[model samples]
Target: SAAKKTRTMTTQSSLKDAFSSYADDLNHLNDKREKVVKASRDITANSKKVIFQVHRISKSNKEEVLEKAHKDLAAVVDQYVARLVKELRGSDFWKLRRAYSPGIQEYVEAATLCRFCKSGTLLNLEEMNASLSSLSDPSHKPLQINILDYILGLADLTGELMRLAIGRISDGELEYAQKICTFVREIHRELTLLVPRMDEPYDMKTKMETMLQSVMKIENACFGVHVRKSEYNPLLGSGDPSYPLMGVAGGIDL
Candidate 1:
């Protein structure tokens, strides 16, 4: 009876030890997830700053605006995005995708915006991920921006394009405004088909509404330009400093 009791106590003790070890591991994982979340917030904030910097681009200071935006984007990748890569594992990438997706989407928006302004072409996801590969450790797999984030980011880009279009019209660059209109329209049309098929459709569905609004805003701006072109041509011809056309360029409600 004494030996049996001792064995039972030993088994209980072993179970306690196992439970303690598992608890410690769970705590460690929770800590890591928290760190990744914090890093993701940092990345989201910095990525937004980069987007705002890109919005500062104008026909007059395209080079200066893009240069500053590029620097800001690089800083976001180095400081905030690098932290995400360090804390996240291969499995964690998809599992924590929602936690970090906003930041990644914003990063994609800034990157493609800069590329479009510079090269007049879309920056493919492969190229964007390749740029981030250097930030990760050699032993680990690089964190690649997934297709959903990329598409979601592209959807947001239309809003910025609308703003750019209105600004371009105000700046008397009507053709540039039209080009923006066309680009945003195409993006909206394509996304309409793709959003329904996404794995998680809620976010994309929300963004689709905003994307459609952006498309309409650009279209309205272009329409306003066309409607008033005859009246504005004379003022432009006379080199009016007041630029009365600016008053007619309505703001997008978005």
Candidate 2:
């Protein structure tokens, strides 16, 4: 009887120790997640500012707007995203992905928009993570933006591109508007094939639908510009229309 009682005491002590370790781990995880969330919010806010800055681009101030946007985007990488990298170092990326995913997606959107506006090309996921590679420790696995987040961010880009196309149309830049239309259409077509295979198919599906709308908006704007040009052609015989974007404001909600 005494041996059995001794065994019971030992088992109770071991159980207590195990649960204490569990509690400590839970607390640490919670604290790290909170810190990561704060950093993510900062990243989202600043990335949005960069997007807005890019939206200020015009034919006359294209260089100036892109220059300022590049600086702001770099600051986001240096400040907020660097903090996120620090928090995630030596940790399982999949474990905390949900905590930081939205911010990363927005950063991708902002960064890609800047690159596209400057060069008329899509910024790939490899180039994006390569930029962040400098912030990571050489000894540790770097925090790379997964293809899922990259694609999701790109899905959101169509909305902004729609807005930009509408604005360009309003500025009498029909050629630029058509360019955006073609780009958005290509993005939509590519995304349609990938949506079903993505990890978060439902979310991607929603974004795909929204992306379709954005594509149509761009196409519609381009069509309207073409129609306006045709109607004005006979009256002005190969000359530019005085108001190419007339009534564009009323038709476009973006």
lDDT score for residue 208 of model 2? 89
Q: Give me the candidate number with maximum lDDT.
A: 2
Residue 212 in model 1: shift from native, Å? 0.3
What would the per-residue lDDT of candidate 1 be over residues 87-124, giving only the tens digit for each residue?
Answer: 88644688778778888887888888878777767789
Off by over 4 Å in 2: 239-254
Report the Cα lDDT for candidate 2. Answer: 0.89
Flag regions of model 1 displaced more than 4 Å.
1-7, 89-91, 230-254
TM-score of each predicted structure versus truth: 0.85, 0.93
Q: How far is candidate 2 from the true structure (C-alpha RMSD, Å)?
A: 4.1
Q: Tell me the lDDT of model 1 at 202.
A: 90
Candidate 2: worst 10 consecutive residues by lDDT?
A: 243-252
Q: Put down candidate 2 lDDT per residue, 16-114, tens digits, no spaces.
A: 999999999999999998888888899999999999999998767899999999999999999999999999888888899999999999999999999
Best by TM-score: 2
